[model samples]
Target: MDRYVRSTRRAGGFTLIEVMVVVVIIGILASIALPAYQDYVRDSKRAEAKAALSLVAQRMERCFTESNTYVGCYGGATVNSDSGNWVVSITESAASYQLEADTSAQHSDGECDPMTLTNTGATSPAACW
Candidate 1:
């Protein structure tokens, strides 16, 4: 009777080594997953910066059409209300314009720090767009 009870109890539970092996496997998987998730988040934020630059470009074009020049457009604004993750700026003259979207203070990083779009519709770091 004593032997039978001990066997039943042991069979019902996992050994320490088995539990530890499972834990180690989970830890290894998490280690691999975490960095990939971070990259995905950073890329999504980059999209926000790109979109902000495009919006600013459209506005500048409108301003040019109305006044035949890009100066004084947007009143020299540096922040775009439409995009929350980027700071937008424009440098322009009667002939051409350059629009830039720099990462906001809180989200700044080297991967996609600043995205640019020009009046000629050229995008820098073209892979980002």
Candidate 2:
């Protein structure tokens, strides 16, 4: 009578199904993270544009207060407001200066809502316009 003992070897590595499952989970997680990261990047860009525009606007406000009406803002600063990519633009109207910003300021397809910030910040950027 020969008695058979179970094989002593244990599973030594991951099975194909286990590997695939892990890969799929990682992919799903990456997919979820990617969009959030993109949105965060876009938000950061918007904030940066706002800060830059605010700086220029304050300068313009000072100039205007001394003279009345916008005296123009940052130019020749190497930051093009009309580039075909991310950009910031401030246009001076007859009574107020408009600070328009977008995540992608170019392509002419992005939402470029003008953030009308008066030069003097009289209303201040934090206030109206």
Name the regions of candidate 1 deviating beyond 4 angstroms: 1-8, 11-13, 81-83
Q: For model 2, state the Cα shift of residue 61 in Å.
A: 1.0
- How far off is residue 47 in model 1, in Å? 1.1
RMSD for all candidates, in order, please. 2.8, 5.5
Q: What tens digits encode model 1's per-residue C-alpha lDDT throughout 1-129? A: 776564444447889999999999999999999999999988878877877787788888898889999888976679664647778888777788888888767878675667888999998877778
TM-score of each model, in listed order:
0.81, 0.61
- Pairs of residues clashing in candidate 2: 61-119, 121-124
Q: Report the lDDT tens digits of candidate 2 across residue range 1-129.
A: 346867779879999999999999999999999999977765555555566667666677776777776634443232433333445566675467655544443333233343334444533234213
TM-score leader: 1
Clashes of each: 0, 2
Which segments of candidate 2 are over 4 A away from where they belong?
1-7, 72-86, 93-95, 102-109, 112-129
